[model samples]
Target chain A: MSVIYQRVALIGLGHIASSMFWGMKASGLADEVTGYARSAETRETAREIGLCDRVCDSAADAVEGADLVVLCVPVGAMGAVARDIAPHLKPGATISDVGSVKRAVIEAVEPHLPESVHFVPAHPLAGTEQSGPASGFAELFHNRWCLLTPARADATEVAKLRRFWKGLGSKVDEMDADRHDLVLAVTSHAPHLIAYTMVGVADDLQRVTENEVIQFSATGFRDFTRIAASDPTMWRDVFLSNKDATLEILGRFTEELFALQRAIRQGDGDHLHDYFTRTRAIRRGIIEAGQDTDAPNFGRGAHSTGRAE
Target chain B: MSVIYQRVALIGLGHIASSMFWGMKASGLADEVTGYARSAETRETAREIGLCDRVCDSAADAVEGADLVVLCVPVGAMGAVARDIAPHLKPGATISDVGSVKRAVIEAVEPHLPESVHFVPAHPLAGTEQSGPASGFAELFHNRWCLLTPARADATEVAKLRRFWKGLGSKVDEMDADRHDLVLAVTSHAPHLIAYTMVGVADDLQRVTENEVIQFSATGFRDFTRIAASDPTMWRDVFLSNKDATLEILGRFTEELFALQRAIRQGDGDHLHDYFTRTRAIRRGIIEAGQDTDAPNFGRGAHSTGRAE
Candidate 1:
């Protein structure tokens, strides 16, 4: 792939930013990449790992003369970072973000961006539970969806960013920011919170020893534990910033959960069976779409090579 | 491994029963194995797949001369199956079950068993979302846990059954039946119900199209779908039989979820962050316990090989 941008600057060196740096170099998406993080420790780690061509001491310095700037901070901190680096952004630079929640991020960052710089917001529908500088690889975004939500003005910049994401091995699409938030609330946000809640409840139950829960996690509960282990600060900002959509989806989840609870209470096996059968169709669709493989016990089959017999 | 039983009979031709057949054969744990399912189609499929040494026409015929009779049916149907096979069970034979709910199964099965036959109930903490005779493999129980809830069980019979499970490549432990129900309610039953409800909610949401949910399931939601895709009949029976424990855990889940929702609504980042951070410890416990591998994306990383870059 050809270089989509002459120079790229990544603000907030976390999982997404670190992956972008490696991916850009691996796929030749950018000639040079500069990076900065709010914490000195993270900057030192990034520098040690050779995460960027140049590890800038400050966000403004990172964006100096860069053709594209990507804000990879938590959603709540995007406004402050945007304001801090707004004055130093080059006149023709394309500015974007990899925030999970789009509508709130655009609202937070758009006011601070200079008119000379083009802002195109993006949310990559990909990640692992791991975070921070050392937790990324060039293939983190491989075969994942990178949703671009560009409000208006700057078709060329949006196109270039889309190409750059494709270069990073992500399939790119465009959507309205509001729709992005709602879709993500259903697909990612609410599911995460629910998982967290389940794990928390399991941890808090005094009658059932925590040791027992950990040992007998089996299939279903272990999956929830993995989801619940995601970065605390990042998810915290996501729920707070994407409040309405996340809350709305969670409301629907509670209502449906209540209905299922009632069915269980009443011994409504037919209703439970029918509802469970319907959910299987959605899983099949996911496998058919190439989003996930059709492996049974998918979460942890690789590490177990059963007994010699 | 040497033969643990002269003849073993499986009372259902579903995933667990079929896997037990293959595992027994692979390890040479049973000299002869027979199988029976309530459905003719399943029996036909079992025969087609060579799932047993002999696929019997009825449960009675399956257990006629067997030293060990395993009831591998759903919990709700256990009593009926036990009643059907009782008179035909070999004298001094050990009858076991692989039901998810133990107390309910014991209540349903014990009264029907003859005094000469020893009842040693067992539950394998192993399986995949896929079901039916063909969906099982010899390695299904490899390195997994098989829990035995023996109630005044004959020492020799319980010992023999434990050895048989060990031959099938599972670690064996003895736990109380009522305690088993409560522990499983927290670890497996409640988590499964939660996953099913979340998937159902996602499928029913009108605002977000099912196509979008399927396509962009991302990580968190996709995990739920995999869990929710488990056999509907098995899950229905689990919930219906383990009613009190499951309902109690779900009640706790709703309370925790409500607290989290309130925190999100009030923008209490501290509460959310603290709660999420604590759950990570339990995940770490699962990893360190070797119940699950410490993979960042444990669900589906094996099949994704990135681009040329």
Candidate 2:
């Protein structure tokens, strides 16, 4: 884990940024790490937690001498942060982002970046429901996928950035920005919206008291809550920015849901059973791929013992 | 921890029955436990694993001389299991069930039970995605809720059954059968149907390769897969048996989902943020009530060590 970047600037002090800071320190991936956040309180918390070697008061100041600058803000705010920091970015610096949506972020931030700097929009496909400057650890990116969408970038710059993420213990892969949005819409965005809708439905049901829903949630609804409780602003922007893809996936979801509902109404047990059986293969595939564990109940007990909040 | 029943008969050696046997044995709540499954292979597994003191060949044989006969079969099969065991139960014996649906189970089972026996329908608000005798453990019911819906049973019989569940490390409460069905429809049945439909949609998406979906499932779809991978036979029966309540919840879910989808389409950030904030409160309630841990990532790391899959 030698230094991959002599100086790295993290332009948003949130979960991804703070985790990148700790991970870089843990792996010696950066000689010096500087961080900045728009909120005074977040910057103060970063200072208190020793989140970075230099907690810069301004985003421009943070990227002044850095060879790498990463925008770690929400999708909707990435443009403003990019514009604010563009003027101060060093020549030959590789500017990336950790936003969930790639196409929208690239469109928003690309115009503001200097032609001299290499802009490679990236997203690390790892996170928890928790956010903020304090809710990060060095292992957040370990063995996780980091999708890098380098738009006609220099090969040497792309490889260096790949090595930096690899140093943080991630498997780096390249994808087109449009394809990334569509894939994420299927994998993350639509699923989250569906979870949120389910939770909201349970809350709106008057017959089943909220107390009962929470008390008996272990059966299945608890998982929906975990996904629905994710950072609101980040998810809001994701759905808004990736509207067409999210809506398309969601439309398919509704159509499929209606089909299943008809099967239930028609008492088609075979249809339900066959559908359920087929989905189990995908779960097995996920486990075999090492993306998810196959312990019963998602292995909550092992992780929630002494360290759970 | 005293013996609540001299002999307890488990009429199906599946997850619930085996867990009950182990929990009862762990707490010394039953002098002897007898188990029987329709499948001879399951009986052999039970005997090999010492899941019960005696693994009987027939439900009638298992229920003989037992003061407590608990039907642990699917809801659709409860009536047949009840009729098979009724003639073999002791005069003052108590008959119970662990079916997820209550009203249909009561309708199916109550007529089959002898007048001398007490019919108490119960649903344990606990389970893992895994099934079968091998998946059972002594701590599966620890601190979980087990709802009992007694139909005009003697107070002594109901009290005894409650104590028996308490001995198994579950918090027991009584509710009307119809109300139990409604509450479960909101909490478990509907959420499961939604999870199943989402997983099925993910599988059916031709553009998104199955490998890609499996690899990127850590985002949100993985949780849906874990739930959708639950015992197909049991879930199919649940949906069919509890059709009315489940359909009701699904209707409400569709309505709420449409509202959220509209908000996303209209670029209504305020609507999305408000709804997300409200759902966060319910998650907090679940954590405070000890139904779920507040750990990030739903504590997947805790239970998903080397033992995953």
Candidate 3:
């Protein structure tokens, strides 16, 4: 396939940024790829690792003449990044992001963007527990869904960006920014919060159990541990930026959990069984829906390829 | 390696039972393996798939001359299975089970066992999100930990069983039944319950949003779905059987989760960040302790090898 963008600038050299760098490079979909991170050390690492064609000293400098500039920083940092780069953005350049929450991102970055630039907030629902420039792979986005919440903009620009993600092996879908946030709250945000909570519960119990939690964690808690092990700063910003929807989902989660607790306390086996069975069907639906692999490799000391250590 | 048991009988032809049959046969740890499930269809499947050396007609018939009789049925069925086969068990045979809750299995099975027979309760903390006779393979037990909760058993028999599991590529550990239940309550039982609750909450959301929950589940709710998708009968029996420990852990989990909810509601970003950071450390411990794998394959549609599909 021919290159889609003459020049693409990645404004954050983190996991998502680096992965996009590798993916775009591997697919040969961009004529030139430049990258910029806030930290000098990260920029040095990116250059040393050959993660970009040009490693720039500043976000504004990186996007000076680029057709596409992707903001890949933590959600809380979007406004500052947008403000810093708005003055240098090329006219008609399509500006997008890889933030987890869409509504907050648009609200934070839109006011700072130049009217000549197009802002499309997108989230590729693919990641590993690992983060950092060295942790990304070209195949990270393969077969994953990329949700785009576009503001009022040129249809051609949005379509071009969607094709960029599609070339990187992602299935693209578009929705309103508010609906995207609410959907993510149920799917990703609430689940992450619960994982964090359960891991905290296990950690607190470590004092009483004396590390037995880690030793025998092959059970269900091990799954939470994997999810909770994700980068703390990114998650903190995720919850903070997506506060309303996250809190709403958490309210529903707590209400359901309380009902389960009451059922357990009352020795209500039927209630437990019914709830468990219903949830089991949803798992089947997920599997049938092709959302998850049907594997129980939670705590097994093997990589995804099933190779044992 | 020599065969540890002259004849081994599996009382259920489900995932665990079929896996054990394949594992033992693959390792040459059992001279002959016989199995019986409640359904004739399962028995036919066992025979068709070559999951056992002999697909027996009755549980009693299967255990008549076995040197080791393993109860692989759901926890609620253990008492009945033990009672049915108690009269047919060999005088010096070792009777054990592969149940999730040790104390309950011991209580249910020990009462029905003859004094001449050795009764040991074991829980292999390995499984997949699939079930039935067709969903098993030889490598299911490889590198997995198998806990033997021996109750007044002869040291010779316990050693032999441990060797058998070791031959099948499992690391064996011994603990008291009560402690096993509590340890598992935190590690396995409470996690499954929480997963069930979260997935149920997602399912119960209005129909318009439930579809989004599945599509965007790659975030964190997807992990819960995998855990919640496990066998309903097995999990239900686990909660009902290990009521005390499960309830205790659930209480602790709810308290921790409520504290988190309060933190989020009040927009206590510090509390959220601290908790998220601490949980990340727990996941690090799990990785360092050699309890879990460290690769991200959340969206990869791979199947657990030994799971019966």
Candidate 4:
């Protein structure tokens, strides 16, 4: 509930950064928070929303006199943003990033940082499909997991960053960069690619009109659209940066899909039932872990006790 | 809200049937509702939940004097259940079904019905992952679409069924059996297959432990797990009965996936970005149609302004 960092700089204000700014202010996580975005319109919007204590014109100015500078840019642009801010970073400041892919981010950002500064890459495994400055709120990271790929960063600095995330209400954990990529590939990246592909296929279906898909999407395809509706630029960068792991997971997914397809073709009902039953346990695990609600229908009408679907 | 049917019989006491019984009671759509499940345990649960006005031991007994007999069994078992109940169905009674697939269900049920009985096939495009008698609730079908595929049923009977569904808080629509199958294949069947495959791949991945997958699944994969956790027997039957349409859509999905994969491999950010942006429009369309919530995070914490993730 007190200031952990005297000054925090958020480079590239977007959903994650804007949320971080509001969350920090709400929780008194820092004394002063500054922000900078490449686009003038975004910076102007940030000012209008009072998103930060100071809205700077450039990344260098935002990092000036800041004890912590967090890169919230797309994965592909992390390096450029790091290079832009490196010269103006305060002495002994910690530079962390909120990129989805950890290994690529470290590769992209660490080299540009001065040895006096700490480079710790962190990824909060939390997001909605919406993006931009206005689409953020203070509690986006609450109860979410923030994975830190410290990878030999100074222990004290890593602990401080972990504490800062904890103060923002995220449970912090550490994992190796490569393992993080593999885990995220299974949990996020490949699933996103699959959702994108499914939505695209639905969009292209001539027999099933787009209006019909939207109307009848409540069954299952609607969920895919929600995932597919995420920020295109960020997701594009995610796939490009986490290419190998994502492709590997997707290859395995295609293999599994083929086996299921063959089972359907062969009328192997038993195989399909067994596979479906096993997957149910994973959902139970997610609910038990508090990552998702256990209420029926994804908690759609949980609060409205007598309401219809 | 007056009773539309004097006596309505539900032949399978699963999620759909039990929900219908409760929904009928909620809206006074049926004066008396009776239900029968093949499994004694399900029958017991129905009684325990007070799911029906009468819980019959046999399907024949359930349909003995009913004006409307709804077959709520899985697609694969419709034929056998229809054969069992056809002998007891009242003269002039409308026998409809709540199966997901239409053409196969009609083929399976129509041949078993007597000339005196009216066979009207319908598919409710609604459900949650949970199944069994206890999972049913009166509000399950509220605002959801219920697609009727009445091939040659009496117009008056079809109108009555549509009114009954509307009384239960559903929006009613009609389509040809073949088109229904194709639309559902795109909207439900293929998406489910894709979800099952993604979850299966996550389960089989050795490097990413099961614990990690479940813990980090708060991202896009969690939604897939919810879809994959749906009633296995019902889904198995759906795939087997709707094989042609499902396969066609899945093939198209594979083609689209491979194209996107190639884009990702070739570092074609433009293609990925463009595709992802197009999908966002579909989500907007769904929201505009009132099929889904526009609140951030799919309305997860929409009611609680500052709730944790």
Candidate 5:
């Protein structure tokens, strides 16, 4: 409810940063938030929309006197931004990142940060497919989990960052860096890649017109497209940065798909039925946890009772 | 609107059948709708819910004098139901089905039907993850596409069936049986198996506890689970019945997934970004087609702006 950070610097003006800015403003979590983006157009849009107290021309300028400088750029750009802003960071400031891949982000950014600053790797597990300065709101992080891979960061600083994220309306939890990457690989990265692949396959299939696929997509393919439509640069960096874990989970996915494919080919109804039934229970856990809704078609459109496809 | 059929019979009491019953009742599409389910419990639930004018103890009894008898059972069970009710179907009645796969359904049901009865196979491209008699609602088919694969049925009967679906609040389209199977394979079947495979992989991973997957699944994996959570018996029959197309699309899916996986392995950002970016256009088409909303998370929960995961 009160100011948790006197000065917060956001080094990217996309969905997460703009959302954090709005969330902070809505909750009165910070005194001033300075923002910067690689694209001048993005900075202009953020400024026009009043996304932050100050929209700086450069990452270094944004971090000049900020006590909390959060790297909100694509994972691949984290190191470069970190090196660029190292000299300009305020004394004893805490440097954190909202990257999907934690181990790689810590590896990419820690060496570039000055010893005076604290480096806490955090990942907020929430987002819509849309990405842009304007496509964010205060409710983006409401009831969402923000996992912090503090690694060896000072306990006090980690706690402070946790409090700040809490103020931004996220439930905070601490996780080991490698574990965080692996968990996210299963939860986000691999699923995203699979969705992208499925959507791409549909697009490439000449036998089925794209119009037909689009027209009949409401049941299943539509959900995959919403996920596959997420910001390309950010997802590209996620796969590359979290390559091992994502590939591992995807390997398992392919193996399972092949088995199910074999069952379908063999007309093994029981095998298919058992596997399908087993997976249903997992969704029950998610709905019970309030991580998702149990509404039909996600209670969208006409079936206005529950959650998504 | 006047009743399209003087007496209608729904042979199964499940999500689609119950919903159709309610939909017809809401619109007065049929004068008297009779219902029967193989499961007595389901029939009891339908009777309790006022699902139909009469709850018959047998499929034959339900179809005794019905002008339109709909088989809303799983694809694999269609042939048996068709055989059981063949003797009792009225001389000039129209028989239809709401199966996801059409080619196999036609082959299985056509031979059992008497030459006098018109058979017009149909599949509604709409549902929630929930199943059973209690899950049905009057608005389940509102504004959704109900695909008809009418293979050699009388034009008048086909038109009447289409009219009935329209009265039930659906947009109707006629597609070739084989083409419908392939189109649905791409849009629904393949996506479902892939989603199931992904969720299964998450479940089998011992290192990442189910709780972690449940808590962190809000963004990506959550959508997959909702899709994968669909009725197992229905999906099992679908895969067995639509074997060739499902396998073919999944083959393409595996190929694309491997290609994307390689891009991740080789750290090829351009390949990953291009594939991801290309897939995004498909969602825009789907949203524009009114097949789905652009609202975030299908306008569910807090982020009520656009569509699903």
Candidate 6:
């Protein structure tokens, strides 16, 4: 429960930033938190909701005299936000970001940051279909993995930042920016794209009828619908920023899908059985590795559990 | 709580059958429920666990003198089961099935049923990734949808069967057999196939490493793993039985996926944004239509409010 930082500046008041603000306050990890958002309405909502100790008028104002400045914007906006606040960042301050794609973010933000500040690119692989400041809660980070890709960061500064995330109740791991993006593309981006695609297909079906889709969705399509409900702006930026890795994963996905389609068309029951059986084992491995909870956990709310949907 | 039938027969003692056994018994909808499984081990388990009042050695024996007979096997096994029980079915008995694909099931089963029996093809859109007798619970069907495709049958029998499902806490809808298959292919089969395919893709990635797939799965691929963990035999039969509809939906899915891929590869942010936005609205529509619960329900174990992971 020890305070990790005296003053923390949150450069965006979206789901991640608001969750971090509440988490830091609830854990007593930060003595003071200042928040800023691109829209006046969001900044006002952040202040009114008491998500931060103070809601600043601008990103520069939020970072002034702060010990830590964390950018939590869409990936496409990282460079502009970084440049906008660079002049106001305190000397020797540690700066970080919670963006889904890391390599692009590091490339976008590092050059704009002054050498006096420590830049650590991080991604907390935790979210819900809901977005914005109103959707965040204090326990969103509990027991979730936070990947940190610190480029040439000082040892002491890196340790301090790691402790900051750990204090927020996250298990931390370190990886290179490019590797992080690649892993995420396989794990998150490709799956999300698939969900979007399947839901779109269902929505576009003129013959099936929408009522039937809604009534009988409990089978499997409902899962895709849940995933497809994620914030549009954030995901749009993710696909834009991590184009190479996302495209690579999508290619592999489409190839496997085509093979499965052929198997189905040929009535190759054994091939379908083998593929399904192998994938079942992978799910068991995920459960055994403590990466996901078992099937019964599908009714729990976001803040109450660390398991991903 | 009135008993709708004096005796009910369950032809397969798997997840759905076992769940129905418990659900009917718990709701006091049937005075006597009998069960039969092809394997002696399963029959013994049913007896030991008291999954049914009587455990018959054969499907024909189970159906004899029963007012209702429920086929709960894989779709591929339904025709044979119907033929095996046809001679033993009580005169004027109501026969129904719980299969994923309706049109193929009716085709497979109707030929073998006696003209005196009323055939109602049903699909309860409720199940977990787990299967077998041990995986079922009494509350598994609560708040779920049950779709029934009754042929030109006795109205009294259809109403009685609908009441039986209602007694188990399911809202019932009736549709034509061919239309039911097409609707489910879009809403259920295709989504499951996509899930299986993506999980397979992740499993095939040699460079990423299994541990990485497990550790970083929170990104998106983990959701598909859960769905892919479903019973392989049941799913294989689903695709095999409903081949035409599934292939048709899969074709549409692939075309849409390719379009999205081209957009991403071309770095067309607007295209990604518009598509993602449209999909998000569909998800919202699903939530509003009451097909999905809005609560983030992915981590809570059964019988506990705590999130599982």
lDDT at A121 for candidate 6? 83
Per-residue lDDT over B243-278 for candidate 5, one digit per residue giving the tens place of the 0 to 100 score: 989999988888888888898899899998898889
Q: Predicted candidate 3: what Cα RMSD to the true structure? A: 2.5
Candidate 2 — which residues are off by over 4 angstroms? A297-302, A305-309, B297-302, B305-309
Q: Write candidate 4's Cα lDDT for A28-124 as tens digits.
A: 9999999999999999999998989999998888999999999999999999998888889888999998999999998888888888898889999
Clashing pairs in 1: none
User: What's candidate 3's i-RMS value?
Assistant: 3.9
- RMSD values, in order shown: 4.0, 2.4, 2.5, 3.3, 2.4, 2.3
Question: Per-residue lDDT for B113 in model 3?
Answer: 87
Q: What DockQ does model 1 achieve? A: 0.50
lDDT of 6 by residue, A1-309 (tens): 898889999998988898899899889998999999999999888878898999989888899999999999999999999989999899999999999999889889988989899998889988877788887877777778999999799989989999999998789999988989888888899899899998899889999777678767764777777788888788889998899998998999889988888999999999999999999998889888876666442532332222242
DockQ of 5: 0.56
For all candidates in order, the CA lDDT equals: 0.87, 0.85, 0.82, 0.86, 0.86, 0.85
| Candidate 2 per-residue lDDT over residues A151-237, each given as its tens digit | 798989999999999998889999998988988888888888888888988898878889988877764787778788888888899
Expressed as tens digits, the lDDT of each residue in B137-190 for candidate 2 is 887788888999997998999999999999988899889988888888887889
Best by lDDT: 1
Tell me the docking grade of candidate 3.
medium
Give stretches of model 6 more than 4 Å off: A295-309, B300-309
Candidate 5's TM-score reads 0.96
lDDT of 6: 0.85
Error of 1 at A140 (Å): 1.1
Encode model 5's per-residue lDDT on A257-300: one tens digit a residue.
88999998998999999999999999889878887666554435
B227-277 per-residue lDDT for model 6 (tens digits) = 898889999999998999999999999999999889888888899888888
By summed lDDT, the worst window of 10 consecutive residues in model 1 chain A runs over A300-309
